[model samples]
Every structure is written in structure tokens, then in C-alpha cells.
Target chain A: MVLDPPLPRPMIGRLVVIGLGLIGSSILRAADARRLAEVSVAYDAEPAVRARVAELGIADEVASSPAEAVKDADIIVLCVPVGAMGAVAQAIAPHVKPGAIVSDVGSVKGAVLNALRTHLPSGVHVVPAHPVAGTEYSGPDAGFATLFKNRWCIVTPPEGADAEAVQAVTALWTALGANVETMTAEHHDLVLAITSHVPHLIAYNIVGTAADLEKVTSSEVIKYSAGGFRDFTRIAASDPTMWRDVFLNNREAVIEVLGRFTEDLIALQRAIRWEQGETLFDLFTRTRAIRRSIIEIGQETAAPDFGRERG
Target chain B: MVLDPPLPRPMIGRLVVIGLGLIGSSILRAADARRLAEVSVAYDAEPAVRARVAELGIADEVASSPAEAVKDADIIVLCVPVGAMGAVAQAIAPHVKPGAIVSDVGSVKGAVLNALRTHLPSGVHVVPAHPVAGTEYSGPDAGFATLFKNRWCIVTPPEGADAEAVQAVTALWTALGANVETMTAEHHDLVLAITSHVPHLIAYNIVGTAADLEKVTSSEVIKYSAGGFRDFTRIAASDPTMWRDVFLNNREAVIEVLGRFTEDLIALQRAIRWEQGETLFDLFTRTRAIRRSIIEIGQETAAPDFGRERG
Candidate 1:
């Protein structure tokens, strides 16, 4: 394994990561790999997950409870599902030390920021962040130190939030090799609703629709999937509980963006029915430029089929 | 480069491929690499494409016209887009050798079979096939000899199509490392509408929807594409003319499948609006199983994010 270069100074004094799943375990691994924090601790509501994390040896300590995990942390990141953000914040609020920066890796920002502010004590700081990177796999073993490397991490700090705390959170992500951008919680929700949440919902919905087809057998769908359907299945295979919570928590933006998607799909359907070849061709050509832009920006691979191995 | 094992005997005495684009060029390359045909000839309406095919030296001879290409060939495969299939078939009809097998790689089989039957001479056997594989990129330079390796190629021969001709087409694809399955033309259209055509329509529609969003800037979508939107963009970037033809020729099945997709998406939207977590979770779980089946059948990769290179 390649070693990361040592940092000039540790970014955080004591770091606590709650919820030792994909994102949480990745933070612990990255912190240890880069020595981003002087001391790194971990906790998960599931006793089994904590035990497995201890076995992975990614954290300096795997705390048995949330209170113990945050008692000495200078920065605490809640990495649980969005629906559980409120309860996880409330559970650790009482023991969180003053001047600590509390952050999260939730997909939705507005609801998560509200949850953090509502439950946490006033003296502590809350700087919510979302690393827009992941694989279909989940759980502790599914993560690696470079999971966030070269990916975007949007930090949505509420207005009038502590500047120093925001800087510390931004520095942590930068040290982990992510490009950091700051925005309002509400704006972050709207942006992600288009870029991530609605896209995922569409993938899940199509796969579900394919599965329920009476004339088409599931075996046939599976067999002929490489034709294009398989790509959607990869994202549809992501953690169901996390995605469920994302939709429930980011309800407004998701519904609004989904409305746009439905409207566009209806127009495309009409074009098909009316045999409007020029209309279909124009939209198809326009969409290709966006893909080119994405590849040029390094957000996506230029390789075909995401560089999937060919036989 | 690794060499393909030589075939016991050439599958066809002479093979002519019309429309030297991605699928056509790939056929030429695979035929030469595996020695599937004793002599391979090529033709394209565009002079530039024919010149490129000659420069690549993939075909034994690059004929200037469809008539010249099929005049002496034993098996002729039309590789043009679905919209151009009838015209290409008619152009080559008078010159096609008697007792030769006329086949195609069009995505939709029923309409193509009809086009071939309507235009071609009675002595030549007509069989329509679709190799369910491709990259988003198009044209001669985008193809490789192994494009069909381990992928499924569905053969839809018209009723009472010559048995010997059907076997020859099957043998040619098998020699190029494809697993061949036989079905009726109508069934092939329906199966592909769900597994390939409709999925591409959804991908194209979503990308179009995202582009038209005033709330989310294109730059933001491009920069944060790693958050799931990029996958749809890959398919959305496919050749516009090719995809438009697919929806047009397969209109009946595509409209039926797309109707199902829209219905399911609306239900998902309602579930999100009502915060129906269990409903979302259940569908997500079911979709994951389809992905697993596809991987287990070797139609998809088991590696995370299609084994895209990491930083």
C-alpha cells in the first residue's frame, strides 16, 4: 500500500466519527492514513458494526456509546442515514465539549442542518458537509482511504455560523484530497436534488418498473442488461435504507426535481409518438455536450462504460 | 496483443458489411481477428467512412457501393441505423447473390425483418440479429475485435427462414465469442424495448431534464456528476441518429415500456411526497437483486462503480 505524505500539522486535535459505515469508516481510514487528526475515535449504534470496525483497526478507539465517542472530540462527524440525524445529534449533544465543530456527511443539507441546530447545545459549532462520491457497495469493509480523493465535498454552513469551525471542517476535507466548496444549506439541497437524489430515484424507479413487467421475464432483463439497463442497476443497488432516508428528508427538492423529470419524459414520449426525429435528435445532441463537460472537469471518467473490464 | 485462437473452419465463404460505423466496423474486426469469414468486404454511403475503413485495413476490400459489396458475397450483414435499414436493404437487393444469407445488426428486429423481406429477393435467406453490446462512442475508430466477446447476440429469423442460413449466422457470432439465442422478431423487439431502448430513452430524457433546470447550473451538474448523474450521461451521450431510430422503429414496444416506466416513477414520486419510507425501501431492495443476477450471469461487472480507476 502507498503511504500518504505527512501533513505539516494535524488538522484536528481529537476527531470522532459516528456511524461506522461506508462514509464513517472512510473518514477514519483517511484520517489515520494521512494523520489528519491527532486522535481518532469511532462509534456506531449497532454493536456489531463497532466490533467489526475495531477488527478493521481503522480508528484509534471504537467507543461503546455516542457520549463516550464525543466526550473528547474536537470535531465530531455524524455519518448516519438522514432520517437518524436528529436522534444521533441529540444522543451526543449532552457530552459534546464546548468549541467542538459538529459536522455530518448526509446527502441532504437543509434538513440535517435543522436537526443539528435543534438538538445540539449552543456553544458547539455545526458545519454540515456532503462528499459527493461513493460506490454501490456499503458497510465498513466497503470503504477505503481514497474514497473521497479528488471528489467534491460541498460544505453548507448555516448563515452566521462560526468561521473558524467552518475552516477546520474545510481543511479536513482538503487534507483528505477533496475539493471543498461552501454554499447555503438550502441551495445545497436544491443542487443535489438535481445532480444526485432525483437521478437515483429515477434509477430505482426504472429498475422497479423493469422487475414488474409481466411480458418480460426478470431472467431476460438480467441477460440482456448490458444493452444499457445494467448501468441503472448499479446505482439502484446502493444502500436502500440510506436512499430511503434521503428521499424522506429531502422531500421538497426531490419532488420538485422529479416533477421536472416527469415533464421532460412526457415531452420525449410525445416526440416518439409523433415521430419527431429532429426534436429527439436535438435533445440527444445537447445532452452529449454536458457529458463532455463532465469528463473535461474530471468529475467522470472519459473511458467508455466507466472503464469497465471487457472480455 | 493477445491473438485469438484460429477457428476450425471459416463460418462464411464471403461476408459483406454495409454501413461501416461502430457495429459494422466491429463486425469486420471480429471477423478478421477470428477468421470467421474466408473474405470480408465493407461498404458505407459516406466516402469518408469508407476511406477510414480502407485506412484501418480491417476489411479485405472496401467496396464503393452497396451493390458492389454484396454482388459476390455469400452472407451480407446490414449494419446501418434502423431508420436506414429499408433503404440499404433495397439498394443491395438486385445485386445480392442467390442462396446468400442477408442479416443485420439493427436494435429492433421485427421492423428490420419486414424491411428485408419487403425489399430483398426471394432466393436470399433473411435473418435479423442484434448483438446487445456497444460503447457510447461511434464510428470505425471506436470499434475493437473483441466487442462481442462474451456478450449475448439475439438472432430473430423470419418463419421458415432457411435452416442452413440461420446456423451459419449463429456460427459466425459464436466464432467471434458471442453467446447466441434465438427468438421471434416480435419478441426480440419487446425484450429489447425494456432492456435497451426504453432505458436509453429514460437516460436521454433525464439528461435533457437536468440540462433545462434553471435552478441547477450546468457547471454545478458537471462538477458534482460523480454523485450518480454521470451514469445516465454515459448512455445519454450515445449516437443521436442511432438512438432516435431505435425509438422510432420500436415504437410499439418502446411506448408500452415507457408507459410502464412513467407510471412507476409517478408512484415513486407520490411515495416520496407522503414520506413512505417502507415502500421506497422495499423497491430498492428488489432492484438490488436484479443487479446481482445480472452480475452472476456475467452480463455485468461485480466490481464497485464498474471498477473505475481510483485516485
Candidate 2:
């Protein structure tokens, strides 16, 4: 069967994806696959990544410097770690062409926007974006063209910025197979703290706890991980440098949600000690609905558990 | 491209999958797909479950009683929760044909073996197994043939058990595409507690806490769950009955691991509160290695965070 091609978006005259890591590379792949841009260029700090892009032919051009990559590029996307955003912004500050829309794919929005906003030159539109998609893997080698298909790409427009630029970025993401949503930077940070940041931290924390256990327990953790803990291990296995930046950059939001999390955990501990089965069951049942919603929203594939995809 | 047809197994064999559910049904799918048995039967106390098995055509025959299911069966495997093992064992105690090999897919082995050893009649060999697999989904409809494929299936046979019976079960799982390992029931429980039970409890606690937050934060949990908490939610959404049974059956191991986890968590929490970057980064880096090991062991698929395998 001949497959229909992805829809075209003529509004995006030029598109450039910077960083070329998992998120950036995925965006490059998706945008290129969908033909969303007239010209798609990828830039990465690492020479190997640039060599990889050349090998895969994922983009029309590969640049080593942020200035050279963003030059004459209508849309520039920053996909570096949250902590690295400031330096990237500073380096590219003087080089950014007028009217060029600058956006990012950072997990933490408020801090990133704050960092980049202070570094940007006037007339260069800055929109902070958080694509609610990713895998446990990292680097250019671990990316695919279909990674963003049907995932969310949130665009947080700064106060009094160009509406047309925000819309254009949103349009570009939509054409790349992402559902676009606009949110306030503060609100985006708060929401992500609970959903993404806190969870990663907790996964990392628990895995650390397991690793630090007595030798008998540590070995047991690895051997019998199939039950549930192994899932956390997979998430916790994410890049340490990236995650450290995430925690340090998104400090307030992470700490706020974490404070609430520790309290709730202690309560559950109390309930378990008291053998309050009804409380446990009630919470378990309520949480089940959220999972159902995730499936219904088409964010998840139509497999109970994951057999439909894995098998 | 044409698919390769599987090699046929020896016929004239009878198989009974006791307590048909996610794992049991998957085993049936694998066995049936491979033509591993001439006749396969299933037993479940829930009439609805039995009817569903018939609806899915998972077995050649559906039996109302454990005794009926095991009658004339060469292999009888239990797939019930850990807590239900004793009752199931006693119910099938009087009806098992001589020389029939009995096995189980319970999570906590030590207690389950203890229960079965007390109830099963002599001459019926008990070979307890725990396939380090499963999804959050439950019931017969949730099963798939490839659930065990490329996953670990640990077999904990008692000392001096019949060699042929153990090998038969091992061969059966091997045919189903599982890598099998043998360990004592006591060791299996301890390992699972650190790897599966404690992590699950932590996920449930954090998700529950996030859910119980003041309205604003609660909504944020759902909206931004793309960050990290959503991973926890997936694990937290597992069947409450199975989890409850897990805690009760593996009380000693779970409690011991929980103690260690709490201590480590407290230390981390102190570090976070005191703004100790070195301490947090050190622990975080150490946990990353475990994640690498999981991938190295081939337990994980090569997908980025939420975008890897669809669940």
C-alpha cells in the first residue's frame, strides 16, 4: 500500500534545529520527514554528532558553531541541557538575525526563558518550548524521524512578544506531528515539576537507595527487578549531567513538588503500617482513571500494558 | 518478506494453566502459537474469567475446578497471586494425577512454596517459577504470547525434585522465548523485594501524594506528567490486588528494603535541604550505572523516554 505523505506547511520559510541530541535530532528527523521547512540544518557541539548527521543525511546542513548554524536561519531551536541554555544564548546573542524566532526544547521553561530572555538581543522573538516527549536513550544515534508524531510540544511565549512568531513555531511543531499548546512559563514549570521532574528525581533516588543497600538486597534488586523496580531503573538510567542541570535549574518547582511528595509518601507509609486497605485501594482505583485518560488521549498506543507494541 | 514458521514441539502432551490471568494467558498464547501441547486446559474460580478464556479461545478446554483442569495433565502451572497459592494448592491436592508436575508463576516464592508444600499431596512435584515479566494490566484479556519473549523467567525448584519435571518446565519456557534461571525461593523473594516491591511502593506513594495535593498542584501533576512523574504513575497503576498480595507475602524482605530506602532517602533529603550539590551528584551518577546495566542485560528496549516503547 502506498502511504500518504505528511501535510506541508509553507509558512515556515526556514527551519533550523540546534544541539542535535535526542530531542533536537528527533525534531530534525520529524521536520525533515514531514517537509515542514525549505531548509533544515542541524548543529551539535560534538564533532561525532555532526559526523553522524552527515552519515545519516538527517539534515541538509550541519554546523559546528551556534552563530554559523543560526545565521540566516528563520527559526532557531535550542535543544541543549537546561544549564547550558544560558551560555548558548549568550554566545548566539550578538549573532541572531533580526526577526528570527528563537525557541527551545528544554524540560524546564521558567528558568530557561529567564536565562535566555536576559541574553537575547532586541527584535529577536524568544519562545520557550517543552516537548512533552522523549525516550530513555540519548544522543543522535538513538533518535528516529517518527519520535514526535502525536506527542505534545508546548510553546511558552514571553510577555509582549511577537504573536506571529509564536504561532509560526507552533505551526511548525504541529506540522511535525505534535499537538501544540501555549502556556505561561511559570505554569509550565509547575506542571512539569509534578509530571516530569519530580518523577525522574524520585526514580533516581529510589534506584540510588536500592544500589546502596546491603549486598544481598542489592543483588536481589537487580535479579528480581522484573516485578516493577526495573521500570524505575530504566528511567533513572538517564544521563546524569542532563538530570543534574534539570534539578539545579528547576530548583523551586522541583523542591515545592518534592516537599508535597515526601509528605504524601509518609502518609502512605502510615496507612500501610495501620493496614488501611480501603485507603490504599481507593487511591489505587482513582489513579487508574488517569492511566485510562492517557490511553484515551492517544498519547498511549492501544495495548493493555505494552504487549501490543512489544509483541 | 515471508515469515519463518516455528519448529514444532513433541505432541501427546497435556498442559494445565491454573488461575488464568495476564501471565497464564500469555503462556497459553506462546504454547499454542508454538504447538507445544496436544491439549491445553485452564482453570479459574471466577466464572467470568473462565468465560473470557473461552471467548479468547486461549485453551482447548476450560475447567470449572482446579481438579478438573489438572486431570490427566502432565504439566500443571499456577498463575494466581501469591496470597491465593495455599487455597489453590489445597483445592487441587486431592485431584492431581500421579506423576503430574506442579509449578507456579507467583511473585514471592518463599511464602508461596511454604503454602504449596503444606497443602500438596506427595508424589506431585512442585516447581515454583517467577517469570520476571508482566504489565500493569491484569486479567485474561491482557495476555499476549510474546510477554515472555526475551524476558527472564526464574525457576526455583526445590532440592531433590525430579530432574525431568524441572527440565520440562524449563524447556517449555525456553520454547516460549524466555531466558530461564534457577534460584531458591528464599533468595528470589529477597531479590524481588528490593527490585520490584519497594520501588512499586515508592511509586504508589509519590503518585498518591501528587494526587492528594491541593487542587492547583494536583492538576499540574496531570498536565506536566510528561516530565518524570508519569513513569511513576504507570507503575503505580498496577493491579492493587497483586501489589497488596506482594507486600503481605514478602513482608520480611519488603520491610528490610523499605528501611534501607528510607535511610537513603532521608540522607538525600538532608542533602537537598542543605544544598549539597556534590552529595546529590555523586549519588545520581552512581544510580545511572544501574540503568546502563539494565540496558546491557538487554531488558530494556532502545527507545527514548516516553517515546520508546508504547505502553
Top candidate on DockQ is 1
- In candidate 1, clashing pairs total 0
Best lDDT goes to which candidate? 1
For model 2, how does the per-residue alpha-carbon lDDT over A211-289 read when each residue is reduced to its tens digit?
Answer: 7666555555665566677778766877666777787777777788788877776666666666666776777777777
Clashes of each: 0, 13
**lDDT tens string, model 2, B169-258?**
898788878889898888778778777888888888777777776644554456556556666777777888777777767777777777
Measured by TM-score, the strongest candidate is 1
Tell me the lDDT of candidate 1.
Answer: 0.91
CAPRI grade of model 1: medium
lDDT of 1 by residue, A1-311 (tens): 34368687887889999998889999898889899988899999999999999999999999998888999799999999999999999999899988999999999999999999999999999999999999999999998988898899999998899999999999999987789999998889999998999989989988999899999899999999999999999999999999999999999998999989989889889999999999999999999999999888777888988899876
Q: Which stretches of candidate 1 lie over 4 Å from their true place?
A: A1-4, B1-4
* Reference-based TM-score of each model: 0.99, 0.86
Q: In model 1, how large is the Cα lDDT of residue B176? A: 73
